[model samples]
Target: MEQQSLWEATANERKERQALQGEQHCDVVVIGGGFSGLSTAYHLQRKNCQTIILEKESVGFGASGRNGGEVLTGYIGSMELHAKKKGLEAARQMWQLSLDSIDLIEHIINTHQISCAFRRNGDFHAAYKPSHLDGMKREQEVMERDFDYKKIKVVEKQDLHSELNTPFYHGGRVDESSAHFHPLNYALGLAEAVEEMGGTIYEQSEALSYRKESGKVVVNTNKGRVIAKELVIVTNAYSGDFQKTIKKTIVPVESIMIATEPLSEELCQDLIKHDRAVSDTKNLLYYFRLTADHRLAFGGSGRSSSKRDQENLFNNLRAGMITVFPQLKNAQVDYRWGGKVGFTQEMLPYMGQLEDGSYYAFGFAGHGAAMSSMAGKLIAKNILHEGGGDNPLEKARLRPIPFHSQHAKAVGMMKFYMKFRDRIS
Candidate 1:
């Protein structure tokens, strides 16, 4: 399989924007150009904020471009967990925002005329084990009783074949509100809209460092610098050395994906009749969907960042894909790629002001596609001093993960434990 991602290979191209050169100034300086950064800039531009976006690479060069295009609903973990930890009201608010995030994506697509092949045909949460259906039942009940969400429809084991061609799942739950699309295309379209609204985006410019002085935050790049009233860091998994504190709050976990060569329309239909994005229940889950070109895009979790390990992971993903759909045993894989996703202890995205008074957002777990957009909007609202006192994600402070320096080892251990549990259960 080619190392390139299917999204990268199939996305529409856009002209490269110039990197930061000489000193510049804006009302807000966004430190990343992925979904969160571009979404923040896009919303800020609507408020007529003089925003400048600095990207180390092209837009969507990070997880925004590399993710499986599953625009799923709710936080990464279950709503019951959120309620148990954050209280029921807070959980309800977060639940509503999760739903709103999907709507926001649809609104942006329609308003901006983004041709990302978006579909709202819904998504399915397949029960990888028969016992997994009990958890799905609890989730469905919580959504109805507490969250007031009624979109989930549970399918029994005998009827599972109607929803999925696989014999792997015992049952499944379908959420008609969830959707999927071309993630890279959506990011590119958002970047275009940001530029159209007079927002400046520097493609190759990286935010090396930033300091607050004289009521302004000065962000310095390799070639230039940006001075602004506020700064927003939406770097996600690429936070790196920019801000060690923010980096420590989340662990970057490896996730890999493969796309099969375009199949016959008849075959595609047979593989997934309803064409809803599907994911199985597991700590290390396999999520997949059909691309607009009729290729099955299958992806799953991984533990290593090395190129050799990535090749192995790709092979493992192919095996997993074939396990789900035996007909794909001989199908050719066209593309294979992997990237790190920011995983937080809470399994939820967080957006708030740092101790330095600069605003930030990250740790979307696996919900970055839609939650990151909501993160952007919330960050913009907070920056503009708009009303957002009710959103739980917008906190007054962020806490560093305990023993974060060893997070790589910790994540590996956790993945092993989860895998063992999956095997036994």
Candidate 2:
């Protein structure tokens, strides 16, 4: 059987193949051409820096292309928790950084004129009971009073009738600034712009090994190898399988998604009066949104098994969607699939240089859409400093989860337990 790929699901779009078959060298060689790799290449080319992007498959073939396409506006870290860990000052900076990710993403999209099925409406945090609403209200109050989360507003159950098609939840919080788009298209758009800016991207160029020797990193690939003064490994979950160090940092978690056939304008409006995206307040998150063509695109984290193909390409998430919006019982599904998302033992991302002049970026967790993109830009900025500063890639100061060793089983257990709670909660 033909192994399935995320890129294969998109419209008949195939990136050009590399015809050259000789060894090559560059100033910087980026392995893994997903969002992080593409974004890093984009920024590097814009800075007039010499760089190349190597992908095991096509551009955006990883989670970047296959994500549920949510443009969330905040970090995965809870504000209250951050305040405790780093105090109010550092927590504020962390919160603001997340908001800035929104602006930076839009700026890139606009400057490049990428047709990515983009939108600007926000996402929602829906609740299933009054107690859930009350807890959300408290969270909202605290966030507004301390962090200026003014975009979040309380939604009552009565007001939900016209907004959502599901009858499951009582109320929720609506954030009017979060957006959703075609993730694959956006990733591709970035890839094209990066190449146009004079960056080299090699598809089917798989990195097999790398090593730091004599003050330079020699990277081995399937076709040929490139020795670079600086090396970046952005493979995320799909690391070369050659680097034990990188592999130990992130454990892959698969997320399932389903797409419904385009509905009539009237039917679409029945669910999203403002065309917003939604996510329920559960550990095993359920997220859904309206496509530009009036279809329902939904996804949720956590899976039934470890084998990527064993759980099946996609299981029916519609029953859960129905619980949220009962009006879609007969909705026609056009696609059903899932892809792997990597997370560290801690939910936070792991970025910055491991000692010895090599850069490592991975574990954006579930919020890779913005975090990965921002991380790449930060990596480029750090590379720019001819003199590495005291705070190279300031974002890296956040220490990685101490229990990186427990990431694999911990994440799987977390998902399994969370799903159990979600079904009952």
Candidate 3:
């Protein structure tokens, strides 16, 4: 099996760019070249701003390329929970922003003419238990009545077989606004668009540190230095100790995925009749979708330990796939890979300027494809003195994870807790 992302394997030719070799200056410097950073640069360049992107690796080498490519519509948590934590109006705004994020993805694809196999085929939030279906119904009602959103259709258990050819799911809900696409292609296309608009991108240019000097932020890198009026941190899960506080704010969880060899057209049609992306209601949930090339791309939250045995990981994921689609028990796994996802204590993403005047947006948990792209544009608008501060996430207090000092132990405990919760629920 290829030890690479299916998206990367199928992507078009990638544009090569030189690394930062000397001192540079720009209006803003974006660290990381994933969706958030690239999208931020794209928007800023369109506004005629001088922007510089510093990536430790090639553009889209991080979660931007490694994700499941589900363009979902909502935060990690439910709208009801958000409303209780914040207010009803605030939750409504957040939901509206999520819907807007989906629109932004479509806009970027169309304006850039990105041939990333973008599709609005919708998504299935499958229920593992009867209670999960009840929750879906309640959520759908709340969304329709309170937020005036009605794209979701609740599928009863009796009608579940018509939507999915699996008895594993009790029922589910369908959100037609959601989409799936080739993630790497879209990221590369965004990079091309950024360069076309006069933005500078430097690969293998890892940012070492940053400090304010003469009313400007000077970023020290491995190969060069960058001085800019503002800075944005878009590293997300790959964020190491670049900023100590930011690192503590999120727990990086490993997500593993495997893509099966192209199945027969009849089998693919039988597997997912509507070609809709699917995710189940479980603590360590399984998400699967029919790739543009007719392969089954299945993924899930892996073990807490980072040093996972590849063979074991593949076996576990294959078993999960077989549980959902028994016919896939003998299918050959073509690709197996893993990536990290940043999860916040609140289980939602946050975006705003930091105390040091450096902007940041991270902690998407597992739902980031659309949100990160939208965050990039919003961050750019905020830097331009536009009305981008209205986002409710800006008001959230960034809290570090409990027992973060004992990282490994804490994560192990978290994994145990989740497993226990899943068992009881």
lDDT of 1 by residue, 1-425 (tens): 22579999999888679999999989999999999999999999999998999999999999999999999997666788779888999888888988999999999999999989999989999888778887788788988998888999989999887888888889989999999999999999999999999999999998999899999999999999999999999899878788877887767777889999999998898888798988888767899999999999998887664668767888888999999999999899999888878866665777888889888888887889878998898888888989449678876677777753655535654664376436433
lDDT (10s digit) by residue, model 3, range 17-118: 999998999999999999999999999999999999999989999899999998898876578778988999999889989889989999999998999989
**What residue runs in model 3 are displaced by over 4 Å at the alpha carbon?**
304-308, 409-425
Per-candidate TM equals 0.96, 0.89, 0.95
- Candidates' C-alpha lDDT: 0.86, 0.73, 0.87
lDDT for each residue of candidate 2 in 113-169, tens digit (9 for 90 to 100): 887777888877778667778777876787898887788888888877656766777
- TM-score, candidate number 2: 0.89
Off by over 4 Å in 1: 404-425
lDDT value, candidate 2, whole model? 0.73
Positional deviation of residue 16's Cα in model 3 after best superposition, in angstroms: 0.9
Name the TM-score of candidate 1: 0.96
